[model samples]
Target: MEYFELNDGNKMPAVGFGTYKLTDPEETPNTVDAAISAGYRLIDTARVYTNEALVGKGIKQNGIPRDQLFVTSKVWISDNGYDKTKQAIDSSLEKLQLDYLDLYLIHQPYGDNYGSWRAMEEAQAAGKIKSLGVSNFPDYQITDLAQFNKVKPAINQIEINPWNQEKATVDYLKSYGIQPEAWAPFAQGYDHIFTNPTLSQIAESHGKGVGQVMLRWLFQRGIVSIAKSAKPARIKENVDVFDFNLSDDEMKQISELDRKEGVSADHTDPKTVLRLSKYTTNLNGLD
Candidate 1:
């Protein structure tokens, strides 16, 4: 697997597994087991994902050594600020059942982000986390936070996919030495985006799935992508992206599929931000 070096000099697998809505209580542990068994080393989770404990259980059940796995989690908007963030990080670590996090991110641009950033920074120095970052932050949020914080974010997780290409924001974030990690690299199958005619045609020609085509496109673009799959077959399909490379023409064909529409909650929307903050997840919900 290819790895991207963050600004702070840590190496993260360019392609990893994402556990977002995958926190379904009944399905998470087995799904996580499948992912790790399939050779996925990086697992992304959040307090909101609520399956950190299950993820931990899977890690233990699979008997994978902790150092061999890279786990990423986030502190939510309501838990922003130095004290709260510090507490939240510990909460996440405890939930994940790990001694140290490979990476931790502020869940949103809202809340006391600056104050939270300080805590993230201090946590890094305190050795609670190996890397720190922000998720769903805009370009200005990237610049604003970087200028003020002593320890700039190593990675910025954002919504990215064939339809919602974040090229501009990716460029902007790269300017600040922040690695761009994609959260929804498939656009959640909206509008049949991944299975579009052009993408499928390209995949067919290369004997690959449309989703695989999209992942190849992202990898070629140098963006670290975290893809999700609850099914075992799909989980293996998602990670089996390293064998093929899309031609430049095919890559541009895939890029032309961009519609600039997001599948999940748009971070730029205040109402979306408000809604995300309103819901508090527990082991039952997040599991």
Candidate 2:
């Protein structure tokens, strides 16, 4: 698999397996194991996802050496302060059964993010976290955090798909030397993405699936993507994007399909911040 060199000088997988909704105790670990067996090295989980333990189980079951896998987890809003975030990091390590994480991110932009960043910096210095980043942060917030913090964020994980291209944000991130990682790369199948006429035509030409076309598009744009699937076939299919290449015309055709719409919660909305803050996790009983 191809890798992106982070601003911090760490290497991250270009394609990863996302575990956002893989919550079933029996299914989560098995699917994670299947993904690794299928050649996925980057495995993403989160404290809020409440499945870190299961993800850890899958990693152990996969029997791959710890150094060979790239594991990532996030600290939730409830654990936003320095003290709380510090504890949250240890809690995540315990739950993930990992001595260190490849990447650790501030899951959202709310609460005392500065405090959270400080804690993460400490963790990194202590060899607990390899890289530090933030998710769902706009250009301004990320810039502010980077300007004030000693360590600039190595990555910014956000929604990037056919519907919401995030062109300006992506451009800004690239210019700033920060890697942009795509979550919801397929837009979570929104607006019948897999069956869209434009993508379908492109896939037909490439002899691939619509999902593969989407991932290839992100790859050509120099964006890292994390795709999730419970089915073993689909999981394997998701990572099979390395073989094909989308032509310039096909890439433009897919870009034109962008509706400038987002599938996930709007980080700019106040209600989103309030709602997310209200949702608490049991990580070290922070709530």
Candidate 3:
């Protein structure tokens, strides 16, 4: 349950539950309920996730006070531009059954991200969004956005794991006082993440699973991490990382496991951007 202070003077949980593909419509609510009960205060969702309403339902069903929870959602690539992003924000609020979001992000760097950022700035000024940021944005893109806007991005959500540490990009963002958040922190199990021998040994030393060790590694590095799991036991394990710490040598061992570029799309590529912009999510039932 460790927390980090954003430049805007707000606290964000260092570890969060990410609802990326929890798309059962029905399963989403129950999974969210399990996460909250397991001591998760941060719930990350996106319009593309198609589970915002279910997340809201879970929050209400859990009966946790709104003030005690940290809710985050994102504007989708298809919903770019100032006007569309503004409407998307209201739609996200309605779907989440909340008045305001703890954090809101532009889901990608494509489309009218400049416009999308402007709309998020207005939303923040209006108190509808406490913190504004971008997910999957490269360092230069973040800088480009920050140059013209008065409110710099408070965070940058990126793919960060043992395989893809993103140190250069992360350091660049930190120079601008932007906190780095790790999505798919486990590398989605790619490259035999959970079964890695080094991580396994580290986990054994801490009496924790490899997943916990991975999160502990990120925590020690001062990065916020969101690990996704539908099982209540896994959810509990993800949040249980606060009890132990990874030694510098152990951390370096994990760092040595780095393969450099694994388990992420090349978002900077025009082909990828075009493909992502073409994909549309169906929020029909959830809405």
Candidate 4:
């Protein structure tokens, strides 16, 4: 697996396993173990996912050295504040059964993000979190946060897929020196992404699947990506993207397929802010 060096000088795995909806107590751990067995060292979860304990169990089951694995979790919207975020950090460490997290992020841009960032900074200074970042934050929001905060954000994870290329945002992020991480790299197979003609043609040319092509495209752009899957075969397939390379023309063809839209919620919408703020979870309990 390849690694990306963050602004803080921490090396993060380029392709990470995303546990967004992998909530089954019995199944999540096994899948996570399988992913680890398939050479995935980066595992991303969130307090909102309500499966940190299970993910923790999987980490133990794999028996890999703690330092060799990169575990990440997030502070949910409800936990956004200096006090709540500090507590949330400890709660996550307890649930994940880890001494410290390799990375911790603000799940959303809403709430008292400044307060949350301050808490994150403290956690890093205290050695509870190795690196701090934000998710679903636009370029402007990230810029403001980075400029004012003592510690610049190491990463900004946002939607980037064939339909939502986010070219301008990505360019700005790179220029600003914040590593761009891609969430929903496959768009959750939206709009029949796996069967799209352009992607299929590109896959055929490279003797790879559309998923691999997409991941390779992101890799070529120097973007870290998170891919989620419950099936072991799919989990193994997602990480097998380092074998091939996409040419400049193929990359351009894929770029042409961008629609500048995403399948996920709009972070800028007021309704989104309202909904996420009210979406509370019991981090102490597993789902």
Candidate-wise lDDT, in order = 0.84, 0.92, 0.88, 0.92
Q: What TM-score would each prediction reach against the true structure?
A: 0.95, 0.97, 0.97, 0.97
For model 4, the local distance difference test gives 0.92
Note each model's CA RMSD in angstroms.
Answer: 1.9, 2.2, 2.1, 1.9
Q: Residue 53: error of model 4 in Å? A: 0.4
Which parts of model 3 have CA positions greater than 4 angstroms off?
283-287
Which of the two, 2 or 3, has more lDDT?
Answer: 2
Q: Write the per-residue lDDT of candidate 4 for residues 9-65, one digit (tens) a residue.
A: 999999999998888889999999999999999999999999999999999998999
lDDT of 1 by residue, 132-157 (tens): 88888888888888887688888889
lDDT value, residue 42 of candidate 1 = 90
Clashing pairs in 3: none
Candidate 2 residue 53 C-alpha distance from true site, Å = 0.5
- Model 2 C-alpha lDDT per residue in residues 62-175, reported as the tens digit of each score: 999998899999999888999999999999899889999999999898889999999999999999999999999999999999999999999999999999999999999999
Q: Name model 1 segments beyond 4 Å from true.
A: 24-26, 283-287
> Cα deviation of 249 in candidate 4 (Å)?
0.4
Clashes of each: 4, 0, 0, 0
